[model samples]
Target: MFKGALDNIPDRVKVFLLSLTIMFCMISTVYANFYIGIDKVYTHIFYVPIILAGIWYRRKAIYVALGLGLFYIVACTVHDSIIDPDTILRFLIFLVVAGVVGSLSRARERFHSKELQAERAFRRVAKDLQLVLESTDEGIYTTDIEGRCTLINVAGARMLGYGTEEIPGRKMHQLIHHTRANGTPCPAEECCVSRSRITGVGCRISDDIFWRKDGTAFPVEYSSYPIISDEAVIGSVVAFRDITKRKQADEVRSRLAAIVESTDDAIIGTTLDGIVTTWNAGAERIYGYTAKEIIGRHISLTAPPDVKDEIAGILGRIRSGGRFEHYETVRRKKDGALINVSLTISPIVNNAGDITGASAIARDITENKRVERELQEAKAQAEMYNDLLSHDINNINQIGTGYLELALSAPNLDRGVRELLDRSLEALQNSSRLIHNVRKMQEMKATAGKLAPVDICPLLDEIRAEYSGARNGEVRIDLACGNHTRAMANDLLKEVFSNIVGNAIKHSAGPVHVGIASEEISLNNKTYCKVSVEDNGPGIPDDLKPKLFSRFQRGNTKASGRGLGLYLVKNLVEGYGGRVSVEDRVAGDPSKGSRFVIMLPASA
Candidate 1:
């Protein structure tokens, strides 16, 4: 404000000249001393400028005073005025007055210089304070006792969507804090900021709403304090900032805590060093220990002594940013009873993707483990019982079949009775074959992956010959292959071939023609020996072909109704890292018989 008032004066010289003219007019026209002062007023015109310059310019006024005296002395000589004693006295007196003013001017100039230096320092400090006010992110404003804005910094003006010049003297609360967060009006008298001034007390409001010029409200955390002087509240200063993100963070934390408390599986949080940092309600229920007994303690506190080291090892891996999941182990309860649990550990990482800790979820699996043990025991008992029954049944079947055969060979036996005997013996034979296939299925499991290279050309030829002889009618079988096709196989490879060929012969309406072919094929950069056996008998239906190799598949299943031959073939072929599939011999035509294709890993 002082700088502004000084700027109104256009020139310092003009001010000095104007003031000097005024002083001369008064002194020359209106002054009269009791002792010849009227005549003495003539020299006073020169004295006025000298005195004025001395007071303003300090010792520099001496030069101006000397120039004026020389001009006056030269004018007296031209104007014919006598050089009287009193005239010399007046000139000397003028010189003495100039010296006296010069001393006074020095004192005044020093004082004025100090004032200017202090003003410049104040401007610099004010500039720094303005920069600070404009540069901050938080809003800062002050209000008078009447709740009208007295001053508002640049940040506060921008936050309220108002210009810095426009905010002062307006009611700040109506503009920025009129509406509550619940969309209700807020009374100025009830406002905390107003009360801070009216009551001379301070208040900190963490959750509130402040409005912008566009009438949008956002979450705010603000502090308000009375601006007091001499024990009297004059105004208030309020500082505030947006707290939207902080509020959202708090809400998310609340929901997560609820989930942790409500879970049925033990959910726990641990530090990298295996110290338990959090334990949920589920953890308490599963471990029989409350949160108060567990948190801040080592996780190994709950692990039994035998698995304590293993638990430490898992925590170590998780600390290094590894995930350990679904590990089944045993842990001792608070009551010293042991129970099985499936444990999973996952690393918890910060924004930098550095693992700081781990979360562990544990679910009890004692009942599942108990059921699994009982199932295994039941299967073993069933196997023993089957072995005993099969042994005794086979002996009875052998005796019955022998007696039927002897009766059929008797002389002059009726043809119908002989046919009955033949069918009975065949039925017994089929039963024995079924039993043997069941035993073979079990034996294959015991010797799984025990494969050796077997040349299949001889095996195919032998099955064709054996099946052809067994069929009474004209049954033709053709074999085409490389000279020697060796594949990874055990002795059971012959059984696979025998089952397919025997099905063709048995299911034929009359004379049937079967074709067998073998070749080498490449798949995924590996060599596999491929073979296809197709028959021209009444073919299988498209729908039934999928289940043709499964157990107890009868007329439509390429397997005997009471036998497990084809099912055993599927298991055996797959166990050798091979596969078996069936299709119609003629494309899309099931009545033209079926084709069984097999692929096996080629022997090296």
Candidate 2:
């Protein structure tokens, strides 16, 4: 009770109380000196307060001891009138008792102060550790030897969708991972903590599942380390995180790998320095080298010796962020035979937008090259034969016409013979026209870039005059023009209108009337010259109009043409970036006549 009271009292009050205690001891000594005999036992009576003061106030007790000892001496001197050995000895004892008690109490207080500081430091360290554990993103938890959860951080509780207060004191496997990823029951024996305890060693599980409070599960990768105490396995500390994104990325990578392997074109990956990193199955067939032989080797292995630096040059361009698509080159197979390949190559960029490598898709074009070569050779030979035939056949028709004309010119010929010779001459003339038309068609094709601006008005006037004198003036021609009419074409533009007028004259037994009109028109934001050639010859049959411009097709059967005249017109106009179409001169009345409309790109 006294110690408790002293604890609540302030230092000044304690000192005041100690001073009263000294006064009480002094009063007792004074009363003894006056009322009773001054004895040796009473002389040292102040030692009692000294012991009390030392117990309560430690080193401060010396003042109490001095007060008691001084009052006793004054009382003795007044009573006995001189300092005695007993008084002196009593003062010395008071000092000795106070010193001894104060030293013991000071030492005790220092020890208690150190102990209090150590306890406060321990609590501070524990608070800091808790904060660190809870602040981390990865879920951290501990389990006992029985696989029960004993401690969990806030992160762990939040990951399991549980409150901090509700997480601990439960079986860890049953709380967050009750079932296997396959949905089968997971026994406690298969738990990570249980296994850790049994084996007395730590283990890591990279792929697993953890259940949430809502009964949904997500992929997790966790590691469980053993918690050792006294050199014995006690529990486990588990650290885990969700790995759903990583799993999805791996699946995408796997699908891309499958597609790359299944394709028929060679898909190759190489480092920016030309080192081959990946070779798909198609590459194996094209290069005659298996993936195992090609991968990790230099890309130059497949390059022909004639172009050994080709692959290195491509890699250099790729490193500079260049792409080569449909680039044809020759490559050497494992058998040392060269093959043509079309390559579409691009740079491979990483997430940081840095070009790391190159991807190339190569298609074997060796067979296509061979077929192209054969076609070109065949075309050359055909052109040669066509040139020879046109030359020889024209000469033959000229000779035949001359012989027939000579026979018709002979005097005194029979009427029937004269008629037969004239008919024969006409047949030869038609044959000569057919050969000339064929040569014109071949010439247009061979001179693809021979187009220049030609005035349509001049060509129309020329065609009109040339046919006006034909067949003894049996053909009538009319011309219409716009002064600004001009088109991009070769000299073959005259033949187009001439054929129309000639067709009208040849297909009619009487005078043929042809109207040639030219005007400038605009179509699809471009300038063009539209010319309509209306002929009064027997109109084209409706059924034959669609095939009129094709080979071997003719107009009305009664006045059928050689079929090449209008076909030639269609080809020449189209070659100059124009269109040609034929329609009934009178709408919906094919018997009236045919109107051929030709639109040509107008030159500025």
Candidate 3:
């Protein structure tokens, strides 16, 4: 209150008031010297005014001292007093008191002014700091050197379920950090905030917990910064935030990684350069290498020598963001055994959708490949038997025909025997035709002949001559094709026409009439040569036509030979990238005739 009143007075008015009080004191002292007698110590009354003037005016207080001194001398002189030593001493004392009091008072006033300015600045700074702490999302608080809470921001107060008024001077650890996450007691010595104050070092705790007012604990990430003053630790400021969501995300990632490690197929991850980055337990089991032995190595370690370029190609595709699905290839195991594997590979993309690496899932297919090889070998063996049987039967039929021809030419041969020999030779020729068809079928299975352009007109004419002579002029073949008509075919092209024409002549009742024609046709934006062989023979039934080209399908159940002719014709045509089909020469007239059509890629 005294300081407040002093602050309210103006400096000039204060100085004037002190001057008046000093003048009155001096005047009273002089009056007392005369009335109250000089022996009564009335001069001491002069000390009060002099000290006040000195303290208020500083060096200017000397003028007041001199004025009072002159007054006393004048008073003595008026009384005819001698020049006394006591009077001189009294004057010197007054001047000394004024100088000392004024100097001390000036120093005190300057000090007081500086203290008030500092106080105001400190208040402004404190207010701004409080605003920052209250507005932040993180909880912030400060504790004294003794671990007692000295200040807590609004956020901190609310976070711990306490009011700011209730938190001051409270033991910080006991208030909100009293227990560990595992429900165990946490001693103050173990508290990071308390430790920071003692150690004078900052401490950060990420996997700890802080309890709320409701006795519930949450995961927290916090740092304790020691507050330092005068090179000593005074207290600590703690800032903390909840990190429950981050912890949950980490858990989910760990679970997914565990699933990948436990799968049965080898799951491998590699960089764009084919350097292995991740190898799971399945990869260890299948590749015979542990994760420690394989990771950080090149992925080519598992590729066979002949297929090293295959790994490079796969990596190239992955770099281009390509995917490979169920691609069967061969890889080498730790024991140097080649194993067939089916691999599914995809690009590993980052969050920004940039391809950074590749991931592959490989399934061992060694057993499957083994079974496939066994099946192919068995099929090849069966075909070999068929080829051998057909070649031997053909040779035997040729020899039999030779003997029949000899017997027919014998001059003394009986007429009935000669007729029998002729019939037998015809039957032998038919048997030879069947054997030849079987051999051709075996050849088709064994190899698909290389294709080249062959003129169809001349080839058909040659086929007609061969069949007409073999049939003893019993069939006539008519050709209606351009002179330069050509198709992509192989040597098997003649067999295709032979089988169809033979069927026509053999099934016909009288002299067979077969017409062969060729034309250019377009399909699927590609040009093809279409050859048609129309015959005036008993047409195939609708029910039988569907299976007519199937192997071992005979026109009659009682036929003398296996019916592989049409089947072999179809296989050979398709081998040259052509197609074959049979239909009625006259639509809806099964008894009228049948037409065999072949379509081959047209050659320029």
Q: Which candidate number maximizes lDDT? A: 2
Model 2 residue 574 CA deviation in Å: 4.4
- Model 2: per-residue Cα lDDT over 487-538, one tens digit each: 9999888888888777777777777788999999988899999999897777
lDDT of 1 by residue, 18-99 (tens): 4675456444433442234444436656666676666555566667666655545544444446666655666667677778
**Which pairs clash in the backbone of model 3?**
none
Error of 3 at 68 (Å): 36
Q: What is the lDDT of residue 473 in candidate 3?
A: 67
Model 3 Cα lDDT, one tens digit per residue, 294-362: 889999999989999999899998898889999999999988988889999999999999999999999
Residue 21 error for model 3, in Å?
A: 37
Better of 1 and 2 by TM-score: 1
Instruction: Give, for candidate 2, the lowest lDDT window spanning 10 residues.
Output: 38-47
Give the lDDT ranking, best first: 2, 3, 1
Clashing pairs in 2: none
* lDDT value, residue 443 of candidate 3: 65
TM-score of every candidate relative to the true structure: 0.71, 0.70, 0.50
